[model samples]
Target chain A: MSALLAIEGLRAGYGETEVLRGLDLVVNAGEIVTVLGSNGVGKSTLNRTLSGVLRARAGAIRFDGAPIERESCAAIVACGLIHVPEGRRVFPNLSVRENLDLGSYARGKPRRAQNRERVFSIFPRLRERASQYAGTLSGGEQQMLAIGRGLMAEPKLLILDEPSLGLSPLLVEELFGLIKRIHADGVSVLLVEQNVVQSLEVADRAYILAEGQFAMSGPAGQIAADPELKRTYLGL
Target chain B: MLSPVILIPVLLNGLMTGAVYALIALGLTLIYGVLHIINFAHGAMLTAAMFACYFAFKTLGIDPYLSLFVLAPVFFALGYVLQRFVIGPASHGEDRNMLLVTLGLAVVIENALLVNFRGDTRTIDVPYAFATINLGFTFLAVPRLVGFVAVFVVAIALWLIMSLTDTGRAIRAVAKEKLGAQLQGIDVPHIYAVTFGLGTACVAIAACLLMPSYYVNPGAGNAFVLVAFTIVVLGGMGSVPGALIGGLTIGVVESLCSLFLGDSLGQVGIFLIFIAVLLVRPQGLFGAKA
Candidate 1:
């Protein structure tokens, strides 16, 4: 399979301090790639830079064989790289349905109604609470809504930033199951997470990020099996 | 006397005036809803709209009612450009920066008006200026009656725009979550400009409605601005319906207070109610979420 999203020599950071230094990664089409990192390792900064919200200090980002390093957030989304940001940033005042509908505001315009139904089927709780404001939902329900909203965009490559955040262990299991089902639909998944064990179970490959670069990279099962790798790097 | 015959006219007068006040506050509230900033330029913008209305009538013989059609769009475009190119870029979506930017804009617009107009109070001589609706108890000016009716129409129109249109949907989404809105590919700057334009258009409509009954000068809008700010706060910052009800309540209170305590001191009734509401329910008449 060809690379759906490819990054080489990626570097980005806030002013005067670099966080992501010469990082290289690839997510081939129809694959689940997990980027596991500890806090302050710049997982969010990497996501932000890839999504074009943060300007990449220096990088070449190829998405579907075209350079998108200079594209705007809107342009990146239009090209079908949907980023479900951390913290489940659903519109609080807007109803669940409105939140889902807004997902296709830029790209999947023609298939908006169709995609919304598809999203609802994936997250039945969202359908039940369709009329309720997003902020009023339970934490798990809000995360479901956030993912459902992202699905409504018809993303070819879905970058989920810490999807299991603040979710109970039971809910995390369900969220991972949902992620697998989403990936089964031919959408490449880039799962960025601090929940390393749960993420590796779902991801086909895993990349451990440490101090702004990948410390170890390989198949998820292989990475999880290596005792020295786990002992020195993962602390597991 | 507290008799129905005497008090009813005063209440009616207050309601009609309150309708116009509601429209003015609606403009301010719309801006606050989307931008999360109390626009310091709102009064100056109103003064500017009043001058435009006056010029449309005096120089071109366009009736104030008819000029609403012309002036609203013009001001809409002006507001769109102001927010899009000026406020949006300068403020970078920060609330404090927006406050400063709008405040600076207000100073510039007011001083520009003062320099150009020379502090002269202007009024229009519309043929309908003296026309009145003869209620059994009192005569209400026809223009004020028209304003009372038109404010509802405008409110309904604004409501429809906010709830129904795609642009409105984008606007609401941005107001709630700018980052999420951007991720959805909604052009945030465009929505901010559209919202500001819609708010300014409301001011234009208010200017047209007021021109028939009110006098205008460089500082004319300053009188409305303070009361509008109070209504925005009392109504809850972004609630359109809240502003409407709050304005009417304040208007009636002001009217009844004046009947007992003369005119100048009577205006304090609005502030008194404002303080009471803030003290009792800090969220104002409506719950605070925009």
Candidate 2:
């Protein structure tokens, strides 16, 4: 399969403290690749660097075969690389509909109406609360709204950062199902998640990040069966 | 005396002045909504627009009313450039640094105006300046009524832009959530510049409306900005309609207080009520409760 995104020698951090150190990764077209890490193994930093919110000190990032390491966040988004950030940061003061509308602000302009309807279909709860301020939504609804927003861009790849961060197990199940549904529709996913078991269950492949770099990488089934991963990360 | 004849005119006069106050406050409120900074340069920008208006009439033969066509777009461009190049970069996205940058710009702008205009108050000789609408109770100056009508028109236009346009939607999104806006591919800095430009355009419009009815000097704009700041807090820091209603309410209060108390004491009376409201509601009338 052709790769949709490729990263090499990626390094990033905040003010003299390195967080993501010399990591290399790839997400193939139409693939679900989950990156699993505990609380502070630069999972967020990796997502931020990929999305261009955090600059990489030394790395080469190519999206759709074009260098995008130096691109601005807007340009990166316009290239159809959408990131649904952690914590479901919806515009609290804006209505759910407005949030969806802005999702097409940079890309998918002509298809905004159609894309919004698609989002609503995928997350019907969002449609029910269409006019409600996003801030007032329950946690599950906000995450759904956020993912729905990312879909509005007609993204080539969707980067989900900890989509299950604050959801109940049932909601997380629903979210994973939604992610599978979204993937079934032809968009690649780079799922950065902490719920390793569920992640491995949904992912075609998995990467375990520890100490600023991936310690294990392979097919999802193989990584899931690894004894060290079971003892250290899975606590099985 | 609280006679109808006296009371009626005071109310009318207050409403007229309130229009100008509302215009100024609208600009301040918009900037605060987006940048979350008080924009210390706001008053100075108004002064600059006033001086520009004065020169357009004095040096060029453009009437103050006609100058609206020129000043608004020019000041909008000026504000855009200021925020895009100067404020955005110099502050490094820190609110406190933005405050200092705007404060420093205000000082520079005011001093520049002072050096050029030199403390001399200036007014133009438009024939409409002396004309009045003679109500049976009292006669109101034509310029003041024009200011009232013009402000409503501007406010309505602004409201339309905010509610009906894509840029406006993007702006509101940015105001409420900067990161979410960025994630959606909205250029946050561009939106910031656009908001500042829109705010400055409002100031330019207010300057145009104020010139025929009022005077211009380096310090004259400060008199209005202090009140605009009060209106912003009273209206709520980021609400457009809030600024409008808050400004009018403050205007009527100021007028009534001055009527009962002497001019200096009236200023005290306004503040006393402002404190009372803060102590009671905390959030202004239109502001959402924090």
lDDT of each: 0.89, 0.91
User: Model 2 chain B: which ten-residue window has the lowest total lDDT?
Assistant: B265-274
- Badly placed stretches (over 4 Å) of model 1 are none
For residues B1-290, write the lDDT of model 1, one tens digit per residue.
Answer: 58988799889878888888899999999888888888898899999999999998999989999999999999999999999999888997576798899999999999999999989988998888989877777888899899999999999988888777668888888887999888888888888899999889988999999999899999999888899888888999988898898778777888888888888777899999888878888788885743
List the lowest-lDDT window of 10 residues for candidate 1 chain A. Answer: A227-236
Q: What is the DockQ of candidate 2?
A: 0.81
Best by lDDT: 2
The per-candidate count of clashes, in order, stands at 0, 0
In model 2, the clashing pairs are none
The alpha-carbon lDDT assigned to residue B259 of candidate 1 equals: 85
